[model samples]
Target: MRQNLLMIEDDARLASMVAEYLDQSGFTVAHAGDGHSGLARLAPDTGLDAPDLVILDLMLPDMDGLEICRRIRALPGAMGHVPVLMLTAKGDAMDRIIGLEIGADDYLPKPFEPRELLARIRAILRRKGEAPASNSKALRFGTLEIDRDARTVTVGGKPCDLTSYQFDLLVALAERAGRVLTRDQIMEAVRGRELEAFDRSIDVHMGRIRAAIEVDAKDPKRILTVRGVGYVFARQQD
Candidate 1:
């Protein structure tokens, strides 16, 4: 069966175009025009099959796309693992950062070519399975403990609930503890592919990770952002 896709965009014309394009590309498409309605369509009793991926627009009629993305990630079991690609008209660095911080798997700015959009979808799907094998490695730093095999992260011995994207971001940084990883390198390692500029998913995922692992999310000590460059995982000071 073709992979199912759920597209949430407020613009009806754009939604129809995207749905048609996705359908022609072999995806069974379901489109919703607002956040509330979109969520309703996704609910269990709808009898509509769950989608393999979600293309979410940041600007919705009722709710912010970030809120919807957060709610989707909070779903239990397999329902929560669906890949999300954020679509938006906001092209600024901060917008991208915010989207990533909110747990989006990828982001694409507006005015994108249909072909490029399709390519991105394909890349993201590939990454879903191609993420590097963890080998069950464990890294301990101060109050933080990361178990890659089980994909669990703990703070002060307490298990922290993290989405898969969050866990991957933390591991990518922790694996090279104390070293700087450029945004591109980090994105490749975490997303398993080359990504576009203004891709803030890394920052977003890191934000979530810091919130879970840091003693103080407001003033993060473990993951320090290097200006104009990337980030470093601050190992425990000996």
Candidate 2:
């Protein structure tokens, strides 16, 4: 299937080149030169199907990319769950961390090779597109319910906000229920690949997931840190 991709970038030349490159890679590309237009395109009333993935530039003319990402997560319904691959300034590790923490599925530094961008795009989609056969069933623990088929997590009957990647990560841990998983093990389980050196800590993502599900993120009782090892998802929860 040819995937539709939306690229929200201020630089026309870069966007043109990227569109051309991604087009040749069998993706249909859409362009929004500014932030507002990009959000408009994603609006539920726009009548166009939401793109499968978004390639977002962090430095847009009308709005900072982080703000846009925050807004994207706040969009009503499934539109808020669209996968995002952020483009950031080279060597800005903090920005990349912040992006992932805020729901971006992945991030690439600016001035990146088109090939790398393509690879990252594929990786993000791969993580979101396929699931182990078992996910068709819901995983429930006390008051925390994870509907893998629906890709939703609800605690005490209230929905918990989590990114697509984070949802998968949670599922990966839940499947193993009492086992302790190292960071690399968690990443491999969720991404189906070896952990990359450039990849940010799984710890950051863990924090985000906790914030969404735990009644108190500061004292998480569900997902516990193993200290000096990794983390373990408690088999029993309330």
Candidate 3:
């Protein structure tokens, strides 16, 4: 099946250009020039090919792009699973960090070349494929249980919904229960890239993971931080 793409850009000319480019590149593209209309096309009942990916711009006429992203991320089903690559005019670090915090898979600054956008999209999809396959088996680490197949995670048998990145981070740490994984190492394992010194993207992702799996997010037990190093999932005590 051809991958379907949702392009949410308010600029009609740019949107048309992008849609044409993606279509020419063999992806079925859907264009929505505004946030509300984009939501309508992507709304549950539309049965619209359930987009495989979304390219979103931060600046919109009717709504803030971050809020739209949050709403989409909060949705149930494959819609929420679909990867989003944010487009922003600002190259500020804070904006990128916020984008990651709100569940975007990737971000690209505005005025980016179409080819580069395609590359980023391809990279995100490739990582999505590399994610650990889900199964019904549970990894029991003390009071925490991760049932991979069901895509469900429980701490002390209490269930929680984890974002895809959070789930992957937990699996990586849980699989190597006793070892320490540096921020760079974790990012490489979870995101397929080694981020820079100032990059806290992995930390943000782990924060969410800890919140879901640990008894307390503030004073985490299952995943412990080793100052100036990285983090380790404490070996379960027998």
Give the number of the best model, judged by TM-score: 2
Model 2 lDDT per residue over 123-181, tens place: 87887777654848889999999988778899999999887788888998999999999
Write down the TM-score of every candidate.
Answer: 0.77, 0.93, 0.85
> 2 or 3: which has the higher lDDT?
2
Model 2 C-alpha RMSD to native: 1.7
Clashing pairs in 1: 100-204, 101-204
**lDDT at 42 for candidate 1?**
73
Instruction: List, residue by residue over 60-170, the lDDT tens digit for candidate 1.
Output: 979999899988877765566678898878556676677777667777888898988898888767655453555565888876888776667888789886755677778
Task: Give the per-residue lDDT digits (tens) of candidate 3, residues 1-238.
Answer: 5688899999989988887887777787788888999888778888765687899998899988898889898777878777888998755678777877788877787788898878777777766655354444688877777876665688677876666556777887887889999887777666644354587777777777766666668988788899999999888642
Window of ten residues with lowest summed lDDT in model 3 = 127-136
Model 3 Cα shift for residue 112 (angstroms): 2.1
Model 2 clashes, total count: 0
Candidate 3: segments with Cα more than 4 A from true spot? 131-137, 156-159, 194-197
**Model 3: colliding residue pairs:** 135-148, 135-149, 136-149
